[model samples]
Target: MKYNKKAMTKLINQHRELHDELKKIKVEMGLEKNLAIKTLFHSMVADNGPYMKEYQELERMQ
Candidate 1:
Protein backbone atom coordinates (compact mmCIF):
# COMPACT_ATOMS: atom_id res chain seq x y z
CA MET A 1 0.00 0.00 0.00
CA LYS A 2 1.17 3.50 -0.87
CA TYR A 3 0.79 6.48 1.48
CA ASN A 4 1.51 10.18 1.14
CA LYS A 5 3.49 11.29 4.17
CA LYS A 6 2.39 14.92 4.17
CA ALA A 7 -1.25 14.02 3.59
CA MET A 8 -1.12 11.42 6.30
CA THR A 9 0.39 13.92 8.71
CA LYS A 10 -2.43 16.33 7.95
CA LEU A 11 -5.03 13.60 8.41
CA ILE A 12 -3.50 12.45 11.70
CA ASN A 13 -3.41 16.00 13.01
CA GLN A 14 -7.00 16.61 12.00
CA HIS A 15 -8.08 13.38 13.61
CA ARG A 16 -6.38 14.38 16.85
CA GLU A 17 -8.13 17.72 16.80
CA LEU A 18 -11.49 16.11 16.09
CA HIS A 19 -10.95 13.56 18.81
CA ASP A 20 -10.09 16.32 21.24
CA GLU A 21 -13.24 18.19 20.36
CA LEU A 22 -15.32 15.07 20.70
CA LYS A 23 -13.84 14.44 24.14
CA LYS A 24 -14.79 17.96 25.21
CA ILE A 25 -18.32 17.40 23.97
CA LYS A 26 -18.43 14.13 25.82
CA VAL A 27 -17.41 15.93 28.99
CA GLU A 28 -20.13 18.48 28.37
CA MET A 29 -22.55 15.66 27.71
CA GLY A 30 -21.79 14.29 31.15
CA LEU A 31 -23.11 17.53 32.62
CA GLU A 32 -26.26 17.18 30.52
CA LYS A 33 -29.15 15.29 32.07
CA ASN A 34 -31.56 15.65 29.15
CA LEU A 35 -32.26 12.20 27.75
CA ALA A 36 -32.42 13.18 24.08
CA ILE A 37 -29.18 15.17 23.94
CA LYS A 38 -27.38 12.56 26.00
CA THR A 39 -28.49 9.87 23.59
CA LEU A 40 -27.28 11.88 20.61
CA PHE A 41 -23.88 12.54 22.14
CA HIS A 42 -23.54 8.88 23.05
CA SER A 43 -24.10 7.90 19.44
CA MET A 44 -21.79 10.60 18.19
CA VAL A 45 -19.04 9.50 20.54
CA ALA A 46 -19.52 5.88 19.52
CA ASP A 47 -19.30 6.77 15.84
CA ASN A 48 -16.11 8.74 16.41
CA GLY A 49 -14.35 5.84 18.15
CA PRO A 50 -13.88 3.71 15.05
CA TYR A 51 -12.77 6.61 12.91
CA MET A 52 -10.15 7.51 15.52
CA LYS A 53 -8.96 3.93 15.49
CA GLU A 54 -8.76 4.01 11.71
CA TYR A 55 -6.74 7.20 11.87
CA GLN A 56 -4.40 5.59 14.39
CA GLU A 57 -3.91 2.65 12.06
CA LEU A 58 -3.17 4.97 9.17
CA GLU A 59 -0.76 7.00 11.25
CA ARG A 60 1.08 3.85 12.23
CA MET A 61 1.58 2.87 8.59
CA GLN A 62 5.06 3.94 7.63
Candidate 2:
Protein backbone atom coordinates (compact mmCIF):
# COMPACT_ATOMS: atom_id res chain seq x y z
CA MET A 1 0.00 0.00 0.00
CA LYS A 2 1.22 3.46 -0.87
CA TYR A 3 1.13 5.96 1.93
CA ASN A 4 0.90 9.64 1.23
CA LYS A 5 3.76 11.87 2.29
CA LYS A 6 1.73 13.31 5.16
CA ALA A 7 0.92 9.86 6.54
CA MET A 8 4.55 8.82 6.34
CA THR A 9 5.60 11.99 8.10
CA LYS A 10 3.12 11.35 10.88
CA LEU A 11 4.33 7.79 11.27
CA ILE A 12 7.93 8.94 11.46
CA ASN A 13 7.05 11.52 14.07
CA GLN A 14 5.21 8.92 16.13
CA HIS A 15 8.16 6.58 15.96
CA ARG A 16 10.51 9.31 17.14
CA GLU A 17 8.21 10.20 19.98
CA LEU A 18 8.05 6.57 21.10
CA HIS A 19 11.85 6.35 21.04
CA ASP A 20 12.23 9.54 23.07
CA GLU A 21 9.68 8.31 25.58
CA LEU A 22 11.49 5.03 25.97
CA LYS A 23 14.73 6.90 26.58
CA LYS A 24 13.03 9.04 29.19
CA ILE A 25 11.61 5.95 30.87
CA LYS A 26 15.01 4.32 30.94
CA VAL A 27 16.54 7.42 32.49
CA GLU A 28 13.76 7.78 35.00
CA MET A 29 14.18 4.16 35.97
CA GLY A 30 17.64 5.32 37.13
CA LEU A 31 19.39 3.41 34.41
CA GLU A 32 21.65 6.36 33.76
CA LYS A 33 22.56 6.79 37.41
CA ASN A 34 22.45 3.23 38.72
CA LEU A 35 24.62 0.27 37.87
CA ALA A 36 21.96 -2.44 37.78
CA ILE A 37 19.53 -0.55 35.59
CA LYS A 38 22.39 0.42 33.37
CA THR A 39 23.42 -3.19 32.97
CA LEU A 40 19.87 -4.27 32.20
CA PHE A 41 19.39 -1.56 29.64
CA HIS A 42 22.72 -2.35 28.07
CA SER A 43 21.94 -6.02 27.81
CA MET A 44 18.51 -5.30 26.42
CA VAL A 45 19.93 -2.94 23.88
CA ALA A 46 22.54 -5.38 22.83
CA ASP A 47 20.10 -8.25 22.45
CA ASN A 48 17.00 -6.51 21.14
CA GLY A 49 17.82 -3.05 19.94
CA PRO A 50 17.11 -4.00 16.36
CA TYR A 51 13.62 -5.27 17.15
CA MET A 52 12.33 -1.74 17.43
CA LYS A 53 10.86 -2.09 13.97
CA GLU A 54 8.25 -4.46 15.35
CA TYR A 55 7.39 -2.01 18.06
CA GLN A 56 7.22 0.80 15.55
CA GLU A 57 4.95 -1.19 13.29
CA LEU A 58 2.65 -1.98 16.19
CA GLU A 59 2.65 1.64 17.25
CA ARG A 60 1.72 2.75 13.75
CA MET A 61 -1.31 0.50 13.81
CA GLN A 62 -2.55 2.26 16.92
Candidate 3:
Protein backbone atom coordinates (compact mmCIF):
# COMPACT_ATOMS: atom_id res chain seq x y z
CA MET A 1 0.00 0.00 0.00
CA LYS A 2 1.09 3.53 -0.74
CA TYR A 3 1.65 5.96 2.10
CA ASN A 4 1.27 9.71 2.31
CA LYS A 5 4.65 11.34 2.92
CA LYS A 6 3.35 14.34 4.82
CA ALA A 7 1.16 12.22 7.05
CA MET A 8 3.96 9.82 7.84
CA THR A 9 6.34 12.66 8.64
CA LYS A 10 3.79 14.22 10.96
CA LEU A 11 3.20 10.89 12.66
CA ILE A 12 6.90 10.33 13.25
CA ASN A 13 7.34 13.82 14.57
CA GLN A 14 4.56 13.19 17.05
CA HIS A 15 6.18 9.91 18.02
CA ARG A 16 9.46 11.70 18.76
CA GLU A 17 7.59 14.26 20.83
CA LEU A 18 5.97 11.51 22.87
CA HIS A 19 9.31 9.80 23.36
CA ASP A 20 10.79 13.06 24.64
CA GLU A 21 7.92 13.35 27.06
CA LEU A 22 8.71 9.86 28.34
CA LYS A 23 12.31 10.88 28.97
CA LYS A 24 11.12 13.89 30.89
CA ILE A 25 8.90 11.66 33.03
CA LYS A 26 11.84 9.37 33.70
CA VAL A 27 13.83 12.28 35.08
CA GLU A 28 10.93 13.33 37.27
CA MET A 29 10.54 9.81 38.62
CA GLY A 30 14.26 9.53 39.26
CA LEU A 31 14.18 12.75 41.24
CA GLU A 32 11.35 11.39 43.32
CA LYS A 33 13.28 8.12 43.97
CA ASN A 34 10.20 6.03 43.28
CA LEU A 35 11.81 2.63 42.89
CA ALA A 36 8.69 0.59 42.14
CA ILE A 37 7.41 2.99 39.49
CA LYS A 38 10.86 3.25 37.95
CA THR A 39 11.12 -0.53 37.67
CA LEU A 40 7.75 -0.74 35.96
CA PHE A 41 8.63 2.08 33.60
CA HIS A 42 11.88 0.40 32.61
CA SER A 43 10.06 -2.87 31.91
CA MET A 44 7.46 -1.11 29.79
CA VAL A 45 10.15 0.67 27.79
CA ALA A 46 12.10 -2.56 27.30
CA ASP A 47 9.01 -4.31 25.93
CA ASN A 48 8.40 -1.46 23.48
CA GLY A 49 12.10 -1.11 22.60
CA PRO A 50 11.93 -3.16 19.41
CA TYR A 51 9.06 -1.17 17.95
CA MET A 52 10.81 2.03 18.92
CA LYS A 53 13.95 0.93 17.11
CA GLU A 54 11.91 0.12 14.02
CA TYR A 55 10.36 3.56 14.02
CA GLN A 56 13.82 5.09 14.37
CA GLU A 57 14.99 3.09 11.36
CA LEU A 58 12.06 4.35 9.34
CA GLU A 59 12.89 7.91 10.31
CA ARG A 60 16.45 7.39 9.17
CA MET A 61 15.23 6.05 5.81
CA GLN A 62 13.16 9.15 5.25
Return the top candidate by TM-score: 2
* Model 2 lDDT per residue over 1-62, tens place: 22233433343345665346446656766554234323433433234554334434544675
Model 1 clashes, total count: 0
Candidate 2 residue pairs in backbone clash: none
C-alpha lDDT of residue 55 in model 3: 42
Residue 44 in model 1: lDDT: 33
Give one digit per residue, the lDDT tens place, for model 3 in 10-51.
Answer: 443556654464456668666432443343334432346433
The 0-to-1 C-alpha lDDT of every candidate, in the order given, reads 0.45, 0.43, 0.44
In model 2, the runs with Cα more than 4 Å from the true position are 1-14, 31-62
Name the candidate that leads on lDDT.
Answer: 1
> Which digits, one per residue and each the tens of the lDDT, describe model 1 over residues 1-62?
23334433444356665446545655866644234333433443334643445545655664
Better of 2 and 3 by lDDT: 3
Superposition error at 30 for model 1 (Å)? 1.4
Runs of candidate 1 with Cα error greater than 4 angstroms are: 1-14, 31-62
Better of 1 and 2 by TM-score: 2
Candidate 3 vs. truth: CA RMSD? 10.6
User: Model 2 lDDT vs. the true structure?
Assistant: 0.43
